[model samples]
Target: MTAPKAWSYSALSTYVSVCTLKYFFRYVANLEPERSFSRMYFGLAIHAGLEAAYRAWKPDAPAPVGVAKKVFMDDLTIRLEDPMIEFKKGETPEGLLTEGMAVLDVWAKEARYEEIISTESEFTVPLVHPGTGEIFERGLKGWFDLVVKDPDTGEPVVVDFKTTARRFSGDKLEADLQIRVYSYAIRQLYGLDRANLRLDVLVRNKKPVFQRLEVSQDSEGDARLFELVRAAGRGVEAGVFWPNDGSIWCGGCPFTQACARWHDNPDALRSHSEK
Candidate 1:
């Protein structure tokens, strides 16, 4: 198994707890996904719209609702041209465009930040072992959706944008691995002892909803994130891969066929490990 040059939250989260075989197929074997889901592309388009709005935003001005909707339309138009997207039942490009616009409408009204420090900020930090405090060669890399100063506290707030079918529960926000990783990154990059992480969620409903959930970084969560990253990295280096069958994600996994082949002849795994 070839070691990934760098690790991202998505990579570590999937490898450590989600599905090992899926990680191997995508990262180690470098296999193209058999199908791409429409929801993934829809989220990408919405993210682009949010980024555009934030980029054009001015302090103490009306939110760029029109700019956001226009960008979402243009972005989704281009994305829809890609024929690989497998739209879910009852989902069409036209319907999604309308739904995306409605989401932006709600998001614009609630857009209030004291200062927009950065948007889509790229970060790379050394992966240090939680137990030994040993820094690994490969770094952890990710992009911050938005970074701003809190109007009330005058503290740095790291924001992540999400398009969810339902509002995230407080427990879900607290337990999210992505949030923990971002919190850890903020400590490393901004030199802050504690991180304020917020999730700006656009809920998909008949009438869309926008909600912001805040989570403070704790030592335990940060330590858990570091340890998970360390374990995932070591597992990859050791060529450890397994399938998590009988799970919800198993049905729609793009690597299902490849995983089936792997089960029949495990020796095939050797070919992927060869340098």
Candidate 2:
């Protein structure tokens, strides 16, 4: 079986669910899902639009948000999906745009675009496999939405972009394991002890609400994230792919068929040959 290049939230989440499923999907599955899930496409469109707008953003003469959103959706070259590709897709592009519009509108109005220090910065931190000396082989990788400086203090801050239709909540952001992981990676990349993390959540509705959260730096939190990743690495090394209690998210899982087969016909799952 092929091993993962690195452990991230996505992989860790999958590992909790059937390691066999993760192994199959990452190393054996021939047919991949069209989109991540039914609701994911909307976020993708919003991310693309935001990237296009901010990548070319200028503080003096800000680019028109409407124009960027329109051009990104209308122009075939800039779209997330191919114009000519015909298939039974997970979600309609138009539907996603309709849902994402209001949130984007909120973001355009309130976000501190003028304070951007950098955009779309990629960071990779070395990760060691629990049983092997493969720090580079399996490293942590993620993208920071924006790195901006506080106008008052000129302190560097990491900004993460997100959108949700539900009521705003900082509880999740405050406890998010990613914050710690990203904090460690960002600190390592910048060589700073105190790095600021911000969560910019844009709520979707007629009257959208903008929620900004400044995540604190926690050494214990950072240690916890690394421990979780290290545990995952151990699981991968031992070929221990047991399913976690993931029924809450199993509704959206892509390996339901294989999972069902494991229950109904256990022998079929044991067959080494990939279909």
Candidate 3:
């Protein structure tokens, strides 16, 4: 069977669908809002501001430049260098700084900002049925952030970056499934023997944290991906869209009002007694 069109970052519907699915999963799983609002907002601002600054300063760099041209330029020369000086202990010279700056710029601007804009076009990817030879196309396809060749075994490794408000000290974090899904996608697309997946969380309040997991050749990560896909499919099938009440995360969700209304009155009837 022929492969379908791959999902691009430019599509709006895909973005909305992914976000909706994530909200549903979080609600179903009863994820807690562990971080404070101040910390979350601060982390967002810091990440955005840093990215904007990097874009402005590095015009020739492959990284994304922000909408504000002057600010983007100013950030490159001034703000970008400060991090290298303070954090890297002056180890990041001009060349290394430029390279790292370019990488982050692409990540921040293309991966973060441009993704939010709505697009008319949709992208799709092909998934082969396990039992049948039928190839089904799925919407919203994207690649893992990083892929590196392992120095020891010469195998490919998938690395993903995550920005958060705080650090996770344990061997595994709560959202490792996201990385596992990305790794699974990478494996399917590349047809590689196996991928050693790693997650690097850039904690805004402190130093960055790294977590590594070697996905087994067997169907472990694939199972997780299937679970996510099935859960999302079930949500769509059952029309079980409801807001999880009293979840602090609901405050930030765009569909909170719709969910709340639905939860309060699934019949869509207004409360006449209140009036």
Q: lDDT per prediction? A: 0.83, 0.62, 0.42
Candidate 1, residue 19: lDDT: 94
Higher TM-score: candidate 1 or 3? 1
User: What local lDDT score does residue 150 receive in model 2, on the 0 to 100 scale?
Assistant: 76
Give all candidate RMSDs, comma-separated. Answer: 1.8, 4.9, 12.0
TM-score of 3: 0.49
lDDT of 3: 0.42
Candidate with the greatest lDDT versus the true structure: 1
What is the lDDT ranking, best to worst? Answer: 1, 2, 3
Once fitted onto the true fold, the runs of candidate 2 whose alpha carbons sit more than 4 angstroms away are 1-3, 16-24, 27-31, 34-36, 75-95, 127-137, 244-246, 264-275
Predicted candidate 1 versus true structure: per-residue lDDT over 1-275, tens digit per residue: 65677788888877876898899888888899887877778888899999988889888888888888888899888988887778889999999999998899899888773588899999999867667788777778899999998888777899999998787787777778888788888878877878999888999989999988898985567566666776787888778888898877786688878887887887677666665
List the candidates ranked by TM-score, beginning with the highest: 1, 2, 3
Every model's TM-score: 0.93, 0.76, 0.49
Backbone clash total, candidate 2: 1
TM-score of 1: 0.93
Error of 3 at 7 (Å): 9.3
- Give the lDDT of residue 99 in candidate 1: 91
**lDDT assessment of candidate 1:** 0.83
